[model samples]
Target: MKTKRRAAYFFTSLKLFLREYRLFVLLGCLCLLGGVVVGVLSARSFGEDYYKLNFIFELHSGSYSFAKTFFLALLFGWGGLALILLCGFNRWLIFPAFFLVAFLGYRLGLGFVGCLQPSGAGGVACVIFFYLPLYLTAGTVFIVYICMVFSSICGACGVFSSASSVKRLFFKALPLSLVFAAAAFFSCILIPLLYKLFFM
Candidate 1:
């Protein structure tokens, strides 16, 4: 009964958060999509050599180890969260955050294009097994963090400029941010394991 109540409360809070910040979520998605489209188009012009030069591709080509992958993902996830927190202090910082999210998408697009180069089937599998989980997890982290930062900004700024408003915003976002962080960490761990299971 206690667990059931907790679960219900969690869902209700999640629904409220989504309802309140859906526009920010949509904006993040659009930016990511735009970057992806650009990356896919550019990949065709740049050719395979260009993607080979990419750090992610280089890493992917190397040994698939759990520690290395998890460390890298954790680094990126923490870095993204740091950027979002920085953005909360100043409006100008949001531009860099936006660019970073889009850049992630661009990288994803490059990976997808590289995978699909020779044939479709293997590429589809790679996307399913690897790219979707890894990049999508990162994307989810960014979107949630960005939404939280945006809300905090609104609370601090002229809009919603009450002490209680700011406090409420911070407390509400804190738990969600922690949840996303854990999700990102789990994805990092999961990705390498998945690679070993399917590819190795």
Candidate 2:
């Protein structure tokens, strides 16, 4: 596709995904609800043997703790898109990106939940503020990949994965890769800004 057409397709793709406001609003509602609940739950509270963060809490309510979990899930959902695109780009790196993004999300989620504790505010208060927003931003980056990946794979035969098609997928993913990097950058700026916006 010509550059203009391609960019237009890309923007259209964004509009289509944004139309599903429920998923985003669902998360937003969860975050708001968390602060209103009366108890908290930690990773260990669930007894999972997987990687765990030791911080615990008894918050204004448990509603916020559950909201943090939703935030984390949304975060990993970003990594999941990154993984799918990694597969599209250099099939070889797919698995690594998948695990790394997932690990980041899980560990970060744990840390964030810690901050939501009734008294857990301080320097990283900013970090906690942007968790959900970052998830939404990164998710858009992922959605673009989904669009490109689907276009590349939809009409192909069962077994003959074409190198040209892979290349196209990679190129399509280039902007999103930049987007992910930029998302991280903007996230750094956004967190502090969000902290001021919400807490200052």
Candidate 3:
């Protein structure tokens, strides 16, 4: 009975959050779409030749270590920040959270373009098979963060009990963010192996 009651309460809170921030969610979706559009337009400049040339050089020259480290650091760092944002609420958190979402969306979009290319098909396959899940998890976490930010903003302006309730509501998202972050961290190890298999 206690477990059931807790589950019910969680669902109720989720529903209230969705209902309250529906517009902001829509805005986030639109921004993601815009990011994708920009990515597609920019894809023409990121030709297969450039990708193959650089990727081949990196494989032969051992410069890929820098890249692998950078990618892991970036993804893990973003995940960490998202997790932190999930447990707190501040009106000031909105811009950075949204920017992270937009940037990730744009990169994912570019990656999709790369996936569609014949030369990049194998790498894209790896991304689809492996990185896609991680990216989706990260995206979900960011969305939740944005929701928290919006909620905090409203709360700060008198919609609720100020920072206390905002903090309470935001912390409710912590479990999901932690789950996502773990998956992303584990997935990071696959990066070099996948690159070797696909590009090397």
Candidate 4:
């Protein structure tokens, strides 16, 4: 009964969020698409020689590469969540959060650009097997965080405004943070193992 109530609340909050923030989400997605378009267009200058470079393929090998990728995803996932929590208290942070969303979109775009590479099957495979699942999960979490922060900022200043608001925000943030943390965990372990299996 309690679990069902919690699920109901989650869905209610999500419905409200989507209705309220649809425009903002759409804008962010457009920015992400634009970044991807730019990344693909820019890759034209990279040339066949650039793709042919052995270092590009070789970099995917070794424990160092996997370690770096795992740590970076972990850092970004948790760090971004931390930032969202910090920003929730300050309305002034909305602009910066907007930019951060755009930047995340840009990085996603770059990943897509890598997959679109004409000659580098290794790069394509890396994007597909190693990066896509992690990014999709992490990126969804990021979008949720950004939207939550934005919503929190819009409501009231800081976490101490009211007892009800505090409780509400906590409940909302808890699931999103847990989901992102799970994504980070998987990105660290699952992504690396998959990378080794396919790429190595």
Over 28-50, each residue of candidate 4 has an lDDT whose tens digit, in order, gives: 66665666566556655554333
> Once superposed on the true structure, which residue ranges of model 4 sit more than 4 Å away at CA?
1-16, 43-60, 115-121, 154-171, 185-188, 195-200
Query: How far off is residue 184 in model 3, in Å?
Result: 1.7
By TM-score, who's the top model here?
A: 1
lDDT of model 1, residue 18: 85
Model 3 regions more than 4 Å off: 1-17, 46-96, 118-121, 154-177, 191-200
TM-scores of all models?
0.71, 0.45, 0.61, 0.67
The lDDT per prediction is: 0.68, 0.47, 0.60, 0.62
Candidate 3 vs candidate 4: which has greater TM-score? 4
Cand. 3 TM to true fold: 0.61
Q: Sort by lDDT, best first: what order?
A: 1, 4, 3, 2
- Write model 3 residue lDDT over 43-155, tens digit each, in one string: 76755433432333345566655446446745564664544454344555565666666776776667666555534655565466544766666666667666765555545
**Which consecutive 10 residues in model 4 have the weakest lDDT in total?**
47-56
Candidate 2 residue pairs that clash:
34-63, 34-64, 37-61, 38-61, 39-61, 39-62
By the lDDT metric, which is better: model 2 or model 3?
Answer: 3
